[model samples]
Target: MTAAKVLVAYGTKNGSTAGIARTIADALGEQGLRAEARPAAEVLDPSPYDAVVLGGALYAGRWHRDAVRFSRRHRRALSGRPVWLFSSGPLDASANKRDIRPVPGATRASMRLNAREHITFGGCLQEGAKGAVARMIVKRGGGGDYRDAGQIRAWALGIARELTDVTGGP
Candidate 1:
């Protein structure tokens, strides 16, 4: 079978989410899949890809507006293909397993895509690197980098496995 084309689309504030997306794309490539990581803004037309991985950095309990809009705009094309959604948030380790607050608009819009999975992972909190409100919150909350590279790689591998099952090869 021809290698499946996978697009890993992402949005980031301080670049952590972008890093995660790159890791995911790299993992998929290592598995002999054709994968490309691109920012949500630059990734036009989901129609060309066999699979799509949509991701964003969550801010104040919501995904980036652009990422949400991208998914909504390409809902039709995405629905006909395999889609996966992921969010980078919850910097507090204690908040890691907690259910992510509903991203109502994004979730509703993404329903049209019939996304196969939605994964939420811990993110990084970089002081002085975000908007005023976010900076204040991080300062008051005593921020830390909560991103786990190992966990991110594991999830990417799992997603690759699912893709292999769907496409019929490892």
Candidate 2:
């Protein structure tokens, strides 16, 4: 039997969300799934994967535009798969401390795709990040890498287990 192929697609600002997506892909691969990470904007099709993990970076309580468009653009293909959604924002410890609900955009996408789950991970802002607001945050010393790699890996592993259980593959 063949292993399930998973897509870890993300929309990111300052590249932090992309990092998380890569981590997820790596973890899923470690669990015996074939997973790849790609920018949400670059993926023209979602039908090739058995499962999809879609994520976006949040700003001002909104998900990234690319992620939003991806969900709308590939709704038909995605709806038929086991889909998971995530938001990467909250540039503080709050995300680790509590369960941060999805932004309105993510919530709507989840509903539209019948996503299996949604998560909000801590965001990162640092020097050299694009945009005036990001630079300002960094200048004010409010920027840092807050993503928890362990948590991200655990999430991906859970997905791997679910996928493997259903597929009867390693």
Candidate 3:
């Protein structure tokens, strides 16, 4: 039989979230699953995949529009299959950071679909990667890369384990 296929779809602005999606896909691959990371807009359909991992870049405490639309548009398939969601935009280690607070309005769709998990991870800030407003804000706040690869890998391993529990193998 063919290995289980997983889709890691994300919406990103400065590419940090995309990088995270790629990392997750790689981790899942290491766990013996077939996984591919794709931009949310390019994913025409999620029906072909056995599982879906959806993520988005958070701005103004809200998920990106493309990610939101993908989740809502594929809610039926997503609800029937295994789905995990993540948010990338907390630029700090503090879990209580105000800027990274959950966006209730933006989470309605994911919550409605009953995602297996919704994790918020720290984002990165690089000079020239963003527009004038973002540049000015990062300049004032002191920009630096805050993502933790180990944490991401651990979470993905957990997902792999969950899938194994249900399907009996990664």
Cα-based lDDT for every prediction: 0.80, 0.92, 0.83
Specify the poorest-scoring 10-residue window by lDDT in model 1: 94-103
Tell me how far the alpha carbon of residue 167 in candidate 2 is from the true structure, in angstroms, after superposition: 0.6
Clash totals, every prediction = 0, 0, 0
TM-score on alpha carbons, each prediction: 0.89, 0.98, 0.91
RMSD values for the candidates in order, in angstroms, are: 1.9, 0.7, 2.3
Please report, as a residue range, the 10-residue window in candidate 3 with the lowest summed lDDT. Answer: 94-103
**Cα deviation of 116 in candidate 1 (Å)?**
0.6
Q: Pick the candidate with the highest lDDT.
A: 2
What lDDT does model 3 reach? 0.83
lDDT of 3 at 87: 83
Query: Which of 1 and 3 is ahead in lDDT?
Result: 3
Off by over 4 Å in 3: 95-101
Candidate 2, 1-170: lDDT as tens digits: 99999999999989999999999999999988899999999999889999999999998889999999999999998867899998998889898889988889999999998999999999999889999998999999999989999888888888998998999985
